[model samples]
Target: MNSNLTVMKSFFLLGFPGLSPKYYRPVSALLFFFYLAIAVGNIFILTFVVCEKSLQKPTYLLFCHLALNDLTFGTLTLPKIISKYWFGDGFISFHGCFTQMFVVHYLGSVTSFMLLAMALDRFIAICFPLRYPVLVTNNTITVLCGFAWFIPLPLMLTIVLHTLTLPFCKSNVIAQCYCDHISITSQACGENINIVLVTALCIAMLCLLVPLAFILFSYIFICVVILKMSNATGRMRTFSTCTSQIFITCLFYLPRCFVYVSNTVGFSFSLDVRILIVLLYSLLPAAVNPIIYCFRTQYIKQHLIKKIKTSRFGIQLNLSFL
Candidate 1:
């Protein structure tokens, strides 16, 4: 542990500023319900993808990685927030805060990379259908998946290492429900941290925005290919395949970009609203990701429907015995 960080002892989270006292209990309940939904939804995606041989393709495998990443991120940040709001337990140890920050950002970057890989898979599958089998073989995809999961760790480790070294003897209140690089970096004052901050910002952009740009280009080329196809049904089918991913991309990226940009440009926002927007983008996707995949992707949908029916039949059969 870095000595500077060890001095923090613990950091307090502000929860949602300006929230009414009367609403705390209700809000805590809502957050707990949200957490449960996220757990169940993502668990369904991860378990079904692994168990069902029909969904063992590259795309579904990517979705499994995504689900696992979401599960990790949500488990790290959400339950802690729930505890903070529900019981006024806002203090997190210095080591704990750093760990949370590392995991949250690490998984965020990995998910972006994983999404990029999935986009590439779609691009090959649709634009070069004949070549897709040759080009995007299972072994090729396995390597790409490995890259997605592993690349972010070392790439972002420098920034996290920089963060862990900064002095933090001042007040320990974090103005949000969790620690992120931005949230924690904003706390360092009195020390000459401007250079460190800028370097970290640059690293964050390189990791996040670069992948986003590639995804955009991949989709743009995909659109051009889809537009040239003569068969409307085939075109629609191809486009539909990308739709869920596109929707998820927008949900995951747009708000994060807005938040980061607004913060960078000194765009004034109330603390409460800023945090609210962050949570919407950060956590909402995990909750909705499985739902979107199951409902949008045909293979997963059919298998999910089958599983539901079988379970329902089992319940009825046991009821008859009773």
Candidate 2:
């Protein structure tokens, strides 16, 4: 350890370096739109599910939690990243950086668990239709959702606490827009044994992969159950219900897994390119979940359509009165 290494008190985000200065505004505007969509879309779906009686099923209840988690993640992460490009305001104080990282990773871990809960919800619904009502209830889901959010807090907190011990006297310019655990930890000024990084990755994969395994396990049995359906119509209908979840899960996990595998294999990419890949996995699900999951759900679809028609009719009547 260099005794004279400058102890950094702050960090700067060097976002999308390859993009010319001339394009920062446009890029910022685009990111702003993404942030807006993520926030508005998720909140809209969350409210719809909560207010609409038909959407009070266990699966939709899980969707509500998922939407709330998405909203939390987008608010905590995307705005700061957007500001980096929008105003060149990339500097963040030490405490601020860690706080952001904690919220980002914590909600992300919660999303993984929520997705697993959704998968199991589907599995039980399809596999044991006769027992579905008793097996899956609002109380059961509420507890699972509670565990999803609660379990990750202390775990992520411990990681962040250990991170606070690392000296970051190195360059404060982070390659990515946000303070990710690995991205921040990589900048620490110490022995750099690499063990810390390895340990962090292992922990992340455990949090991410274990529930992913559960989702896969749920689907395996789900597929088997669907195949055993006596009629073609029933099979197609059952399979249709799983399509939205599987699609969103791929959108959420595939880019992440790609990044992990590429890093493991030393597959090199430019900073801008790699950041884009990381952002894809981080933000895409937030944007897609409302559309794919909400729109595809029959009750939500019908309710939204009905709501739109009534609102339009009210406007038309008001115009006539005018």
Candidate 3:
């Protein structure tokens, strides 16, 4: 700690530097819409899974976990940015900012692990159907999902704690929509910046790459099993079940990897462009995940349709009596 370091109470968030102040209302409105969509879509999936007894299997349980994680992530990041644009208030307390950083990274790590769990479930079901029931019990899935949520806490906390020890004598204005590890740590004034950054980067890579490698290998094995199936209809049916997860996995991982790789390689984009890329990958997948599940997964689609029709029939029956 330096003697000249100044203690600050709060930090300001500068969102989309290139955008005009006049556009703030529209941007806020748009963000609010997205937040609403993310909430409703993921909540619907969770509600459907919880209420339907037939959906209590390992795959749907994993879907519920992903849905819950997306809902939490969207809630964590979107509201403050929306308020900043809508009300011209961007000040977040010093401790609050670090807390946000911890939760954001924590949820991201949990999601990566959850996706790996999903991949593993699919791999077992497809690659070794006969053994799946014995291997992937409800208790087994519960423990896997439990570890996904629990295992990342210490790593994320370590990064946040390390960043906290650095003295931020520079500007308190964060150059992005929200507080994140890189943006927050960049404000520190010291020679220890590189060490902190490298540590954070290594932890990030570990959290991201390890599960991604497993997911890729699992899918490869799954593909091999699918190809070996002699019947064309059976092959198509087996592959279709995994398509929704595949779409979501690609959507979540590919853009994120591109963003990280580009940053590491010094591929420069304008500040606003980089922020937009982050928002695209972080928020878009959450909003669209349930839609993909509903439209792509046959059982969920049928169940949703049946529920809608039953509600409509009940409403019509009440109207006739009235």
Candidate 4:
């Protein structure tokens, strides 16, 4: 490993094996639609949350932010992933690799932190109904959302800076479609023990344990509170609103817990399994969030229907004028 050697060219990615060149066109077509679905769904969620005035509560405000984060999270990887498959080239420059790494990590960690904030909001709303308005105001959620985005900036900077310092004179074939930190760092010419350790610790704290603790604690308390209610109707309503969030919390955290805990300890599953698990964490939540909220909260569904009808009516009016 020459200390003076610097990166000369970009690395090409050979995506996880299983499928063959014979299936590339078909698989790439499917991937394009899937990516489009995720992008459109997340964008709709964010746009609806912002445009709807009735959804001005703290919970929904945080939800809007979550939707935005989800869109960014998907965007950070999916565009490049689609390109790789469509163009039959997964190669990315060193700078492109690092940029994707930072964006993905930054968006992902911020989303996790936002979930934590949402959990706290739920806890406060359920436990202290009388003081909910005063306690969890718009300003409060705004501040928390800002904090969530900003909290991980320094850590991400550290990761990026450390990543760039390492020489990449060795192999550059990234095993994954995007510039995954693990795959990229695995190719570094220098010893990545410290960086890997630091990253492991951050993943544990930021991605896995903290969010897990929050979800567990909040749900436990909420369950106890809900169970004590004798009115079946009241219980049903309460459960409906909360069940979606709980489902999302579980979906987001479980695979993350597995990956973070296992990867850090040097026990990793196959690349296919790992990518599938991460994809589950990424795509499922975005897909289900709107459905869950719509079914659980009638207000959200009504709002959506109303918006659609209004748009259709406007279209009809324009057609008549034409």
Top-TM-score structure, candidate number: 3
Which lDDT tens digits does candidate 3 get at residues 1-322? 5653458779998889999999999999999999999999999999999999998888889989999999999999999999999999999999889988998899999999999999999999998889999999889999999999999999999999888778888899999887899899888978888999999989998999999999999999999989999999999999998999999999999999898789889998999998899888988999999999899989989988999999999999999999
lDDT values of the candidates?
A: 0.85, 0.84, 0.92, 0.76
Instruction: Itemize residue pairs with steric clashes in candidate 3.
Output: none
- lDDT tens per residue, model 1, 1-322: 4366666788888889899978888988998998898899999888888888878887888888888889888899988888877888888988788888888888888888888998899988887889988898768878998998898898678777887778886678888889888788777754557877888778778878899999999999999999999999999988999888887888788888887788789998898998888887889999999888988887788888899999999999999999
How would you encode candidate 2's per-residue C-alpha lDDT over 1-322 as one tens digit per residue? 4442346778888788888988989999998999999989998987787788878888888888988988888888888877888888889887888898898889888988888988988888888889999989999999999999888888888778777767776678878878888778877857642666766667688789999999989999998888887999989988988788898788878888888788899998988898898887888889989998767776678888899999999999999999
Work out the TM-score per prediction: 0.93, 0.94, 0.97, 0.88
- Rank by lDDT, highest first: 3, 1, 2, 4
**Superposition TM-score, candidate 1 onto the true structure:** 0.93
Arranged by TM-score, best first:
3, 2, 1, 4
Q: What is the RMSD, in Å, between candidate 2 and the native fold over all Cα?
A: 2.0
Best by lDDT: 3
Clashing pairs in 2: none
- Give per-residue CA lDDT, model 4, range 80-186, as digits (tens): 66677777778787788888888877777887888888788878877777998899999999999999899878888778777777776768787776676777777
- Residue 131, model 2: lDDT of 92
Give the backbone clash total of model 4: 0
